[model samples]
Target: MSGETTNETWEEIVVRVLKANEVSLVTYVPDNVLSRLIRLIEADPFFTVVAPAREEEAVAIVTGAYMAGKRGIALMQTSGFATIVNALASLACPFQIPLLLMISERGTLGEFQQGQAIVCRTMRPVLQSLGIEHFAIQERAHVEFVVDGMVRQAFATQAPAALILSPLLTKRAA
Candidate 1:
């Protein structure tokens, strides 16, 4: 697993983790880094992939899915995270609904977009301020651990939890 030739694609790892967690509903705002993973989820009969027009819409949909007794996860980019702060604070937080957020980390090290950088830099702090628990995954090997741990915490606490995947871990294949 350590060799260069043995690295698993993020889509493969994400599919495995979501299945293992028995996640039935997925809501996402489109993101290139997460596109493959989203496709995999859509192809699987065990998962229902919902693409919303906006990040907050995805949040609201996932929140409703959780209420209906389904396990849910939301996938979005860093800028999307910025857009859903209010929903996270008002709907998700107060309800203590278990939600798994898979966020693509932007605005860091090699980021070129100024607006993305601003939101990316503040994403974690924003989650912290909302009292949302989260973890960042920067390698393929760390994906399962981070995803599993966050899912467990979110379910156990009946609260929203997030796992941020850095660009280093989700880089598109050359």
Candidate 2:
């Protein structure tokens, strides 16, 4: 599929997936690719969106939300993933707190920033090193399948699962 037809707006897709999973809490650091999604969740009364002071803080908050019997997802950029590595390894790994992480895949094709490229190239290996389960969303057609499967698996395994969003799978607002 062409990029235009394949990359649906993030808000429409994410709202559907989250509602299907019955997720009630969302914690995230601001991400440009995910701004529309954040806004959608913010406007929904049934969902609670928490903007944490730091990436790790978002991890901790989601962990707590899970323990409180609320399903939660965290949104952040690839670099923010690096910042929360320690927390994912220490807290989420051992405690088996299932988290749906919506991550912007940086440093890939068409990326302008050098730093984003470096980290984007290495992000998967980093997640692998930490043993976190993850899936890349490269096209809109894969969003529902990837998101639903990962979310279910994360909760079933009681571990963190990630849906990595690449620019190829998204489009900038016109």
Candidate 3:
């Protein structure tokens, strides 16, 4: 595999792009696909990582961090996206807090769980309804450009944004 022409692993690219965008506070509810990025983010002294009991807490944590003049993001799975709607609507949106969401797309692309499927089906519409912008990342090539652009746009406009990490990108265990 040494001289392989394989796509870059999503976690490594995501972490590098995040650091370039100056992200400092990171919060997550924990997902298998996101674990690799979490470890990298935790290891960097520039970042402060928090594992909240729920997804909504991650949203709130980033919102506060944003107000305090820090760049922040939340990483979670599609299922956890279901739990953060209220927090995003009530806190993040109306207040215009800039947040970057890195979500591992579950329930689509060969998902085994019915719950994940339902959440996956609704995640985009939910984000749209909240006036949050989202972009899908299925190729490694799109990571740095799309993520960097979205994060810059989000903070510049002081609004929430999402980057949907497709199963094809994560290549994770179902």
Query: Model 3, which residues run further than 4 Å from truth?
Result: 1-8, 172-174
Residue pairs with clashing backbones, model 2: 107-116, 107-117
TM-scores, in order shown? 0.91, 0.90, 0.91
Please, what are the lDDT tens digits per residue for candidate 2 over residues 118-171?
877778887898798988887676777778789889988898988888787775
Q: Once superposed on the true structure, which residue ranges of model 1 sit more than 4 Å away at CA?
A: 1-7, 172-174
lDDT, candidates in the order shown: 0.83, 0.83, 0.84
Judging by lDDT against the true structure, name the best candidate: 3
RMSD of 1: 2.9
Off by over 4 Å in 2: 1-8, 172-174
Instruction: Report the lDDT tens digits of candidate 1 across residue range 1-174.
Output: 223424567677777777887888899988887888888888999998888799888888888888888888999999999888989888899888887888988788788889887878789889999999888887776776777778877898898998888877877343
lDDT at residue 20 of model 2 (Cα atoms): 80
Ranking by lDDT: 3, 1, 2
